[model samples]
Target: MIVPTRSSFSALSCLMGRLFSVYAGYEQQDAHEFLLNFMDKLHEDLNRAPHRKGPPVPLPALVDEAASLNVRINHFWCQHVDRHLSVISDLFEGLLVSSLTCLVCRKSSSSFEVFSCLSLPIPANKGSVCYLQDCLKLFLETESMSGEAAWHCPSCRQKRKAEKRMIIARLPKILVIQFNRFRCETAWQSKKLQTYVQFPISGFDINCFVDREQVETQPRPAYRLYAFLNHYGTLATGHYIAYCRAGHGGQWYMYDDASVTEVTLSESDKRNAYILFYTSVDMRHQFSSHP
Candidate 1:
């Protein structure tokens, strides 16, 4: 049996349990098997002894490594082991369509990529109260890549200035938003952005960030906040804890290292939020109906 040694692993396990509970299509046995496989792989990869002592490793890197392993393990099980369990990918992965339009020729090109998380950049402006909507706006904002960084337009047949933007092509059952608070300009220089970003605890409408055509065709999807990862302290040294709500009872709990405590909704929604997790409201109802 795999044991949780770190807060990140425990938090992830809790989030996965929430996901499995909300999606009745996934079998408990299969989910348990997947978790075991993920933990085993993560332990093996992270426990490799080095030849000599080196600089201290960052916690974020280890968390990211564990997450990547989870994704890979989920993909392998869904694709190679059992195709019916592909709901794992459907719950988290979504398609993002990026468009690059040439300013001179007025021609546009588009590409689609699947994304598991949205990493939003924090503005450099200091002492400004920020909101999640502002970060979403910044993410979708069109930017003109001019000068040497200009894109090669096929129609213009030259390096020309282009405007690039990204929009959601497909929506997933679970949406994960990552606020990039860590900044590192050089190897030795690193800092954390302590900007206050306000996010809705429930009824977060994502239609505005999606493609216009998608909004017109499908019903507007609203999400309810269920879990979030919080980071405390500076960039070089910090701790990661998670706040999650029970799928059935709607009670919030905080997971810190080996301790778990019940917390109020107000307590769960804090400025230290680093990774936010939301689930589609409609799917929640659909799965709750199942025994």
Candidate 2:
């Protein structure tokens, strides 16, 4: 009664095949041909039988909605100084005033400024993929992609849970990460944050999210009172790596726990730099008594 066809048979692979085909033919401009190809893809998707028990990720949307912001810069530190002359301070002012002085370090000696100007042997050309990669890495660190563990606020202090809300104070190259640690505000009540926190700069929670379900309900007795970083989809901009070498040349990320390496910045450290934030997601302050 019915005709068996390839589109109906092995539908998923066929759908995948259409995707590949579309990708390959994307640059080809033929309205009639494109319409036919598009129709084929639509048919494949509609007919593709999916088993929900399989992997969690839905098939890739395959549609390019917008461009990604995975951008970076070579000798970014040098560039940072160039951009934030104020952060570089006297040297930047000197460079602006005196043509001979180095703009970055404000050194009078020709050798120091001259040597400093040479960034990365051959500085990678601007707007290269390397820069984009750096941007992506920074985004990952700051947003939901950040993998650092959580710390708990005092009121809902669990084993290692922190509040969802975050506020920061930034000055030049100095940054204070303010986390809401749970401690007693007064004798009677447990408060969110009485003191402004100055957590060390460290790797961020990439997957920031607020548990809509949990926020409304009581956190599970076992795992109560916690906030999410970012999860799944979140809005973000700019990026950077905030880490230092712990041992060897191997760098380490800063975290709520013992991972962060505390360093006091000096005028020298501030030589050629400005603040760079990797990502900032709209965080959840509080929901309700429940999860």
CA shift at 289, candidate 2, in angstroms? Answer: 57
User: Whole-model lDDT for model 2 versus the true structure?
Assistant: 0.26
Per-model TM values vs. the true structure: 0.68, 0.14
lDDT values for all models: 0.67, 0.26
Worst 10-residue lDDT window, candidate 2: 114-123
How many residue pairs of model 2 clash at the backbone? 34
lDDT of 1 by residue, 1-291 (tens): 133468766676676566555433333232223433454444334433332134333222234432332343334333322222233444666667677889998887766666657788876763656889988888888888899889999998999999998867667777888888878879999878888788998889988777564223254478888888888887646777788887633788888867888888674358888888888855657566533
Deviating ranges (above 4 Å) for candidate 2: 1-129, 132-140, 143-148, 160-291
Candidate 2, residues 183-258, lDDT tens digits: the string is 4558775532222111112343322222232122222111110111111111122212233323322233332222
Q: List the candidate 1 regions with Cα displacement exceeding 4 Å.
A: 1-85, 126-128, 213-217, 267-269, 282-291
RMSD of each: 13.8, 28.4
